[model samples]
Target: MASAPQQSLPLFYNDLQPLSSQQHADFKIRSADKAPFLAKQHAVPVTVEEFPLVQRFMPIVFSQGEEPVPLALMGLNEGINTFFDEDGSLNEPNFYVPAYIRRYPYLLARLRPDSDELSLCFDPTTDTVGAFEEGEALFVNGEPSETTKNILQFNEQFEQAGARTGQFMKELKELDLLIDGEVTIQPDGAAQPFVYRGFMMIDENKLNELRGDQLRKIVQNGMLPLIYAHLFSLGLMRDIFGRQLRQGKMPEPQLVQPTA
Candidate 1:
């Protein structure tokens, strides 16, 4: 085992956190209100790790001030992407020479010492200590002896369905309305964009009859399905702040100890 990262500490998060909002009105090229909505969708009551962990508390988020933040649903993506540290073996350089090389031990001076003893000096890779961020490693189910292999059957299906839905919306919005993107704008002086989620709107019942409820059927079937496509007053705040570089865009990023 290697030493832990230095960044292990108590980090508390709150309802209102750092959200980037455009300070200047002139820089805004698109005259639409940013799509700003609390990502409460992921918190929809469901089973996790065969235990009711999330439902114990009512999940909620809101805009506290000028800044806008978006919370996305992690759902099964967290469990599915998880893997073990010792899952794969290391690839040593020039691992071993067959018996052919051992016969002629004079070829490599390193093997000369072992040939007399009928042994081989393959390699030693596990000597070096590994590094990881503090508190990033946790024993799932309090069982540290065994590591888990990520098996997200539903998570994979969820990702595929979300991709298809995004494409479908792009096409629909192009044909039905010449929307630059998902979010629309008010016909006012600013022409500010209104938060428009194609997945959220469109009346679920209407699509149920039209598409024969393929989307609805996915979620109802116990897959944390992509039922809504969020587009609202909240601009991609993380994009504005370049948080993807510092933090990350994906959900449940592997926790690692941050080092100086």
Candidate 2:
């Protein structure tokens, strides 16, 4: 999918690829489907359920280890029960089904925060933006379900998984290149349903759809190779005394109080 030219937002403090500090502040890129696809952060389970509606059929469990089967199985039409639990003490078997994770390795996105006691549950393939509590489950008969505070807040799966949504995420982290990083669609009268390649804008209006997830696809697909460079502050600087001077800090500066 080709991304249109859009106005990029000013850098946010958290997403600027934070420096690795005292384990309190550190960042690394995880593959959504690649190693660097996800920003660095610890994830844990806030909720785990047996989603029967998620699978196609009840399959046999082939295992020797005494592990509880995964509560969430991929490609299964039958749904599973989801237990909402969070505490450092919770074990993988307490929340996760070994069978499910085995079938779908990327099913869960775990994260732990130093300030919170709860783990966040996320369906990496279909989880919506913001908190997972607000999102809904994937339905067997049709599409995935999610709750939204506003209609405006939603992940619209366009283009028939023109890239299988799950497959895309898994491969992105591993692949070195995309056939074309960006694309352009003229929508000519001569041809119908034309798909373009590479990051060329179809029009300016499409830029309104820009979101964090889309940004990742664009970057992985080759639209923005050096997109990282634009995310840092040109003026914000850290001082010798652990002071952050927001205004442009240069090697030479003015001493207002007259240095001794």
Residues 55-139 of candidate 1: C-alpha lDDT, one tens digit per residue: 1221111211222111222211222111111222211232221112111111111223345321111111111101223222213
What are the per-model numbers of colliding residue pairs? 20, 48
Candidate 1 lands at a TM-score of: 0.19
Model 2 misplacement above 4 A: 1-21, 34-48, 57-62, 65-260
Candidate 2 lDDT tens digits, 188-233: 3524332212111112233234567766767676434222211121
Sliding window of 10 residues with minimal summed lDDT for model 2: 233-242
Candidate 1's C-alpha runs over 4 A off are 1-181, 185-206, 211-220, 223-260
Worst 10 residues of 1 by lDDT: 10-19
